[model samples]
Each structure stands twice: as structure tokens, then as C-alpha cells.
Target: MEYFQHEWLERNLNWFEGVSKLIPSTNNALESFNRVIKDENTLRERLPLSRVVVVLINTWSLQYTANAKTVHAVPTLNLGLWTKAYQWATEKKKKIVSHVNSEGYVYFIPAGQSNEVTDLEETLNASFSTFEEFKTVAFSIWTTTIPNDSNKWIEGTCNCPGFFKKLICKHVVGIAIRLKYANPPAEAKSVPIGAKRRRGRPSKARQALLVQ
Candidate 1:
């Protein structure tokens, strides 16, 4: 258990808090692309080492990169983030402690609300489906700053983990909404707040695999 925690659960593998190391906890992107190559180009066949290299070097990589990824004509707000901003703004529950300093308008946002995971026993017992869900219950007080010119709320820096990873957080967005600096799109209101990743592996039939 100690070995696993130090190796896999720590920064070398999983970024639990991930403040400085703003990277994903899982190597899902590389693993997903590996699946694509194995199933599509290799035809799920155990080829000779030389043959595999030839296919990868001659065909797979070139074919995959033939087309560029989709590029939006204009920069757009992430739907999920917009949804969270809307939810935080609409709820109007959490109290924001604000004051003016030499730098900017400093707001101390209490991120933790009364929720589950009261004790270590309860935390251990709970079957959290995903890391995101497990981490949804935050207890930290995020220090957020919006410049004197409220129009620059988007430039706010937040001490929260979300801001560190994505360069934006609910605290900044919530304050921006309150200060009339930004607004969530209309679609945000309809988005389901409690959405979670589908539990368990997808059915084999749904999974893309080449079978001889």
C-alpha cells in the first residue's frame, strides 16, 4: 500500500492536488491513441517486430496525421465551465469576503459547502466512481483577485486547483458574474450539474476492435 501510494498515487503518476504540475492524473490520451493504432492499423494481429515497425513507420502515423484537428473559427468558452459558472451564480449561496488592496479587489471564496465525507471512515467507505466526483468536495478557501477595472475579471488569479489546471475556476467565474464582468451562455442553465463518467468499461460490442 505504501509503495502504491508513493508511486502511483503521488506526483510521479497521479497529480492529486496538482498545483504546480498542471497535468492530467491519467495517461488516457496516449493509451487511447495506442488503442486506435493497435485496432486500426495493426488489425489486432500479432505481427513480427519488423512488420509492426514497417506498418507504424510507413502507414499508421502518416495516415492519422493527414488531417488537422478541428479548429473553431472563434474562441469559445468551455461548455462545462460555463455550466458551473451559471450554477454558482444562480445558487447565490456561498458568501464572498472581499476587500480592496493596492493590487486589486481581493475576494476570499469559501469553496467548501456542507456535504458528505464527514469522517475518514465515511471517505473510505464511499465508492467514488471517478476522481473528479471524489474531488468535488473541496474545503479550501480560494483567494481570487479581480483588477480594479472590473472589466478585466477574466485576468483574475485564483489559488484553487481548478484555476491552476484549467487557468479558470468557479471562484473567479462566480465573482466575475457578480461583478457583471462576464455572463454564462444561455445553454448553461440547461446543462446537468451532476453529470459523471459512465461507470465500468463500455460493452465489447461498442468497443472498436478488430477480430480475426
Candidate 2:
């Protein structure tokens, strides 16, 4: 634990908060000084211990002399990046489900029907023999996205942020849901959202944004 703490300190010396016994003992400041001195010449890089010590003192002197000057730190990024990630993942849910196969290849049918269901197969598959099974699988998969110590889904890595900065990771899951419906082996069906399948009205905020 002490060694790990020391390594952490070395890596983040510039960002140090305060002096505490709990903090690791690592002289990264000295090491950085050494690097600066040796940077100019190959022979100096291999300098003897006496020369190295002199070089270090010079580096520290330079740093202290320049201390009064102000330097800008990196600017804070927008908090909207997180919000955008959530929205993107939610919207892309439908696309990810379109690519699973029985072998977990590029294609697989959802559990239902009698036709051959490919990953891109337009039909929904019903793998479970009964509604109870379908419910169990859907609920189980859904819960995986809830955050936990294991990072089941909510906090773990999903390619959403990497693909598009704010994309929600649900595209793959959405595609999977559709694939479940596409399964031709059983009699599964795509149930529409009870409210309505078509867009009926825009939210007030959306209308306002459009007007702007």
C-alpha cells in the first residue's frame, strides 16, 4: 500500500493537495529537476554524481526565481458532456439489437416465430417458450444497466463516449431487444409502447428550441 501511494504521488506531484503522513514519500520534484539539467547534452546526461547535484541546485534556483510569474492551468470542460452521453446512449438503443446471432455472431434471432432470423433479419425472434421466460430475460438484462460495485452496466465501459462524445450506450442493447423480437424459432412479438407508436406532439422545450 505504501509503495502504491508513493507511485501515485510521483505521478501527481504537481497536483498535490497538502502535506500529510498519509501522503506518499517520493521526490518527484527532485527527479523533474534532474531531467531538466540532463536534457541538453548526452555527456551531461551521464554526468557524475557531483555534477548531477550541482545541476539539481541550478534547476531549483531557476524554478524559485520564476515563481512569482502566473501561469494558466487547463480550462474546465463543459458539464454537458455527461448529459449528452446519457441522451446518446438512450437514443442508440434500437440500433445495437440488430446484430446478434445464435452463436452470438453477427446474427441471432430473438425468441419466437418459425422463419430463419439473421442478425439483420426483419422478423423478431422469441427464444423463450413462454411469456414468463421472456419477462425474466428482459428484466434481467435491464437491471444490468443499473450501477453497482461490479459496474454491471451503468458505470462500466461502453463505446458510447468514444464513438460520439455524448452517445448513450443503449444502441447495442436496443438492437439486442429488436433481435429478441426477431427470433423466428418461437412466437415472440414486438409490443408497441402502450401510449402510442407514432410521434403525436413535441415537448414545449423542443418547440422553444426549434423557434430559436
User: Considering every candidate listed, which one attains the maximal lDDT?
Assistant: 1
Each candidate: what lDDT? 0.64, 0.35
lDDT of 1: 0.64
**lDDT of each residue in 34-124, candidate 1, tens digit only:** 8977887788888899998888877755664884334333223576677777777666556666779987998766656632223433543
Which candidate's TM-score is highest? Answer: 1
Model 2 worst lDDT run, 10 consecutive residues: 182-191
Candidate 1: where are CA atoms >4 Å away?
A: 1-16, 19-21, 48-50, 57-66, 70-81, 98-107, 114-138, 143-183, 190-212
TM-score to true structure, per model: 0.47, 0.20
Residues 1-212, candidate 2, lDDT per residue (tens digit)? 45434565465565532233123245674696466566743245566778767765676557668894334232122223223333333342232232323323232223322233233322234355555665544322211122223212222222222212222233333333333421111111121222222333323352345654
TM-score (C-alpha) between model 1 and the true structure? 0.47
